[model samples]
Target: MGRHSRKGAEAIRPDAAAADPAGRPDVPRPSGGRRRRQGPVPPADGYTPFQDAPQVRGGHPEQREPGGGWGTGPQPRHETTGGQQRSYAYGSAPGAPDQDAAREQAVARQVSAQQAAQHAADGRTARQPAADPGAMPGPRREFVDAFDADPPTPVGTPEARSGAGAAGPPVEPEEAPDGEPAERREAKGGKGRTFTGIAAAAVTTVLAVVVAGQVAEDSAGRGAVARAAGVDRDGSEGASRSDARPTPEHAVTRAPEVKPLSYGEKMAQPYPIAADLKATGKFEAVPGLAKAPGKGQKYRYRIDVEKGLSLDAGLFAEAVQKTLNDDRSWAHNGAMTFERISSGSPDFVITLASPGTTGEWCAKSGLDTTIDNVSCDSAATDRVMINAYRWAQGSATFGPKLLLPYRQMLINHEVGHRLGYNHVSCRTPGALAPVMQQQTKSLDIDGIKCKPNPWVHPGS
Candidate 1:
């Protein structure tokens, strides 16, 4: 029996040696091929069985007996550490303390250096880098530093920098022998100042353009107002403020006598009698009238009286003309005609009369006069050819009734005939008498005076 037991132990010893080269005490040898129970085992020398065991993934113990009395001896060699088991790389050992301690000392040195740098920077002015993080170095940073150190002064100020000033571009500051900061030179290079120059030029151009446009607009407005007001008779001066002008109301207040025609006034008023009669727009009459040809194209008075009149050749003829033109109704109705005609010598022909002669003539003819009666055609002609002996205005029996108004009426009536207006029967009973009515034979019992034909407008 002793011999068989010895042979069996020898066979197991090789197997155990192969399975656990370190002879780990946690594993126990079974009694037979039937296997030993798997369990926690008490170790000799108080060494913990699991103190450095291969780690179980879940760090828990599997159910088993202390002595290896189990189904499988140490589990298959291919088996992985279960949740209850722990493991280690087959031959690796713990690192030496000396190497680890040396690494810790190096880390402490790095930390101390960083803290010292931060403390040194805490009191000084922070340096402003021209380049932010990841910026390139050289001229870009130098220029930025120069600009920060010196800024341009305000323009037009006495404290302003020169056109070529200290803020221009990079200039190295002078240094002391010991490397201390020395006084800086005025920055001189205009190079790399292109951006500033372009910006300044653009601003100047924009301002100049705006100013020029304002000036042009102001000048144009003033010119237009001056033309509209026309050349001042008194030759008044105007205000010179750039941003303001005399309003229309202000300009008008200064000159009451010189009435400026408004657009509305001009539009509402009628056209003048003759556009050129008064070059200066003044309408006063002149003396020393001249003789005119008989052509009706011009304002030449042509009249022919029947022979045998008692009136003075000139005075009577003049009176006849003056009376007819005075009546407003006659003038408005265009009772006078300016037709052209050839001559026959008789009384008088007034020429080159002003444009308002029709009105002037009416006023003149109303004057009282003494003259013999004459058989004259009652009419106002552009030209007057009267017979001194034929008419005999005052000498006749019924001649006294032919007052200035009546004579004027007669003249206007005849002129109406020449103007292509025919005599017609009166439309209204006891209405005013028309200048065209025949009043030579009967007295006017109805108190009728000249009235116009409502259908036609009147004018010279």
Candidate 2:
């Protein structure tokens, strides 16, 4: 501090003070006029001074001291955000302008205050003359957090605080979908963000797996369908001739190409087997039941038709039941009723089969029907085989005119053997032959010619 360190600015320049007419340091006068001060009389007491005592804050130019200059003083603290600035002066002397605390505080950065504080902290203990009680506060070091300072403005504003190089207008707080400030809508603890991230990851994973599965299916299906479809994915024809193939899901499905049958070709029109016909040995039993309607000992039987036979299996089954129970057949007087069955144990299986199939089954019983191409009872197995060839084509003895009776006699003879009857001949000449007779070969045995009969008791 100089000689005016405790006072306001030296308002009257040094020359003016020195050239006073009264020759006093306090009073002054003009050259051509009576000794007087500029515009105002000096007070009885000196004007209040702007203090600049060593190691102490300066004070305002309260009123005015004789010759006080700028120093420092107690300043009101101000805070700002985003770097805005303003300035003003308070408690300034009437005729003297000195450092103002308001102006000091309005500065955006307190660089001077920081330097002053640093000097104080470094133990610069040089003391100056005592300051007036009405002057600035006592000098002391202040330690604070080395926090960064910002000017006053809304957060995230686009404008530069210095008003230079601002690209656009300042930004205001954004509103959320619910109309609240976006900042408020944000999750402070990160819980919302965490949940959102997890959901996104899960969705992504699910989509990836689904896409992968579909890709795998398409890849696997492509080649298999190509050969069948004979069409390629690359718009070419034929699988072996093309590089890419269509997916199986897109492969065309075609119904079997079967020629429709006419009345002559339908199963209703029975087809004849060659005299030398042989067939698959597999058989299918006729399905369902026929109750034993008469009162007598009942016997359940199944009707089986060999596979590949061009004959009506139902007709064969129905004929067996109807013929056996006929008054002229073995079921005469209902000595034993016959029940047709598909399931459960049966007394026997009456099989209508091709000549070859019939021969194989008959051989199981040590019976030979191939010599005459006749039907036989395969007593060794569950089947009583009727030669389908013979069943379809009447014997030469009966001829086609007697075809029905011939078929009836065939069933009666074979099944009769299964009923514990042996072959017999007609005793009385011109009488009906025994049902057990081998009529398929010759109705007249040993020249004892007899009428054809298909009954246990010829009269009954």
TM-score per prediction, in order, is 0.22, 0.41
After superposition, candidate 1 runs with Cα above 4 Å error: 1-299, 304-310, 327-330, 333-402, 442-460
**For this target, which candidate reaches the highest lDDT against the unseen true structure?**
2
Q: How would you encode candidate 1's per-residue C-alpha lDDT over 318-409 as one tens digit per residue?
A: 54444334434334444342322225432334222222332233234441111221122223543321222222232121244433344444
lDDT of candidate 2 at residue 459, scale 0 to 100 = 65
Top-scoring candidate (TM-score) = 2
Model 1: lDDT equals: 0.34
What 10-residue stretch in candidate 2 is worst by lDDT?
A: 79-88
Error of 1 at 426 (Å): 3.0
